[model samples]
Target: MKLDLTIPSLGPCHVDSPLKLSKQKGISTFNYSDDTQKILYDTSLKNFEACLAKGEAPLAFEKAGPREKIYFDPSKTKAAIVTCGGLCPGINNVIRGLVMGLYYRYGVNNTIGIKYGYEGFIPSFGHPFVELTPRNVADIHKSGGTILGSSRGKQNVSEVVDTLDRHNINILFAIGGDGTLRGVQAIVEEIERRGLKIAVAGIPKTIDNDINFIEKSFGFETAFTTANPIIRDAHNEAKGAYNGIAIVKLMGRDSGFIAVNAALSMPDVNFVIIPEMDFELEGENGLLAAIQRRLAKTKHALVVVAEGAGQFLFNNELGTDASGNIKYHDIGIFLKDKIVEHFKKQNMPATVKYIDPSYIIRSAPANASDSVFCGKLALNAVHGAMAGKTGFVVGRWNNQFIHLPIPVAVKERMKIDLQGELWWNVLEATGQPMEMKS
Candidate 1:
């Protein structure tokens, strides 16, 4: 599928950037990013060859960084930041990064933090806005969760824009996942309809790392890292008793990155289940049969299942949540009961342990790697906004940060390619069958 990588802008940038860097061509010095700099959407040689053979320009995204020229004047620019959706490891790191980048890097001192997601924008919510500064946000990176707080739900677009206008906010840095980014798009449309020059920038903030086009979203590495030890502990738990089985339920709602990665990292995981693949609980080739076989061989087993996995087993509809996402049934608990019943029916003794570390992993502070990534994402977002870029989200693609339009970024979620090498590696690591269907 062809993607439109064009980024929308308020107008031409004219103000000079406050950051000083050498721009000499022959000298070895740091240079500002040119508007013409772009990163290819598809870097594969096969795709490049086919595009060249067809005489079509390959799709590309605008490289994200600081531009020599900016549109908003530092002294007059009033910036606002709001974090929405669920909590992740590095929300505070991102918030602090934005505040520091705006205050010190660009001399943009007028910054405010929205209290509770989009609800802060609605006056009736009665949420107070906090003034952001380098001093106040100095140690926020040391903590987990967003200091500004977060929520899941849609707010009125017109009312949100009205709040921005009332506060004379020129730049808005919205940090959230799919739902929050969609909200940002609506606010952008409202601003455009009213001919406002407010620049909206999104920082993808999902622990699932399901945002489209981004190679890795912030807080993902931290999540899997935090989950690594839990999987190992589960492995030990399984190995401790006779016919022991340990099930670890991780935080991948739509994608299985966390489950697969954590299982791969721990090696002792016998089965890795995700939303992308389907499996049955009964029959010869079903998960239960496989577990029985595993216990017969090793006398112990470990399973890692994503929260969104095995959702087809549920009969009653749980409906959607406040963010319009389907409320998934507890697959981990379901699998535990099914396994216990199946073993009992077979007249076999089994010890079962279920661990759900979703909240613990999500609320922990970001590790060293994710902390650095969050800071970079935040700074790049500020750079784009100051350069007049709007309706765009900052993401890293092919190891480089780039500007992605909100519409395109939220078009679809990034899922594990079951046919690709990652899944192959996962299968190799876990020694799980490619198909667990009857």
Candidate 2:
């Protein structure tokens, strides 16, 4: 095939010195260095053609139904509760509620407690069980530590499943924080792999109050309730004793929940410092300046700070145990020491009083709201399982006890609904600052 070629873009007569035109044989081919057409795309049938094709008897089944049905056995009703991580105050209340709900209300008699958390549930460690009954948990609502006790951290998923199978407990309730919930996920996945059926539910119970899905965990209410009176009484004492400032630090890692609550309880509080807020700690002169300013106007002022507030204290926080766990020391003590040190340095005339409320907050008796929340959360977990619902953490949303799915909660990060602006407004009205310094 003989063909004539034209370089249309460039002028025919004008050529660069380095350019050359070569002539070929009669069977002329535009012999480029490389030639390959890799793709020849195609389109699917149109409406008419597709309609003409057979619509019925298209055969393929990707999967079949399960060989064995996993229906709940009414006669085989059993439950196991495990508490992992540090002991939160309302562990007993949740356990008590679960037992009571399962036995008296639902007639589930064979409830056993998984002793010492998921760590003890491992086959490597001998499986320890607690025989649960209404009588056993009679006064547990007022109790502190888990009656079954608890261990910290997690175990392998297979190990958890093996332990679950060993105990033959159909329903497992995990009581702790985020770590405990993650462990539950692992165990659930493994149980699915084994084709075994078990209902896994997580009850939020962290002093940190960082877990998602649950807006408020069981013990946090108790903690605040326990701290409320001390805050009131402490503020009163500090006010009566001196015309100076008294700082009370509560436990909260970064969230202002605890400090915010304490500050609300003592509205005359001078300043509230939580990790979520600003992280600046000042000397006595600044605090004293504010206190004296308030005292000049009013009497004495109280301040609430979070436990995780680092370096805001005069005394170094106490170290943890041999296991390398950090024990939260008194935030109040830190404030008190700083105030005392500031007074010594400035030689101020006002009597400075420093009091740590860490011990008092932990020892706080269970409050009405907290006890109710804890009990409700336990019942929610059980019923949620009986209904075969999962990934939801029990909480009070819109003044009703409900399940907040973990997927939805994680995407939202268990945060305060700033968009609503109502909670924030109420907080500000209660004398809780969104941010506080020193």
Each candidate's lDDT (Cα)?
0.94, 0.59
Question: Model 1 — which ten-residue stretch has the worst lDDT?
Answer: 21-30
Clashes of 1: 0
Candidate 1 residue lDDT tens string, 108-153: 9999999989999999999999999999999999999989999889
The number of the candidate with the highest lDDT is: 1
Pick the TM-score winner: 1
Question: Could you tell me the lDDT of residue 435 within candidate 1?
Answer: 94
Give a tens-digit lDDT track for model 2, residues 3-30: 1111011012111211122334255732
Pairs that collide in candidate 2 are: 332-356, 333-356, 336-354, 391-406
Off by over 4 Å in 1: 26-28
Runs of candidate 2 with Cα error greater than 4 angstroms are 1-70, 123-127, 282-289, 295-299, 310-334, 363-365, 407-438
Model 2 weakest lDDT span, ten residues long: 2-11
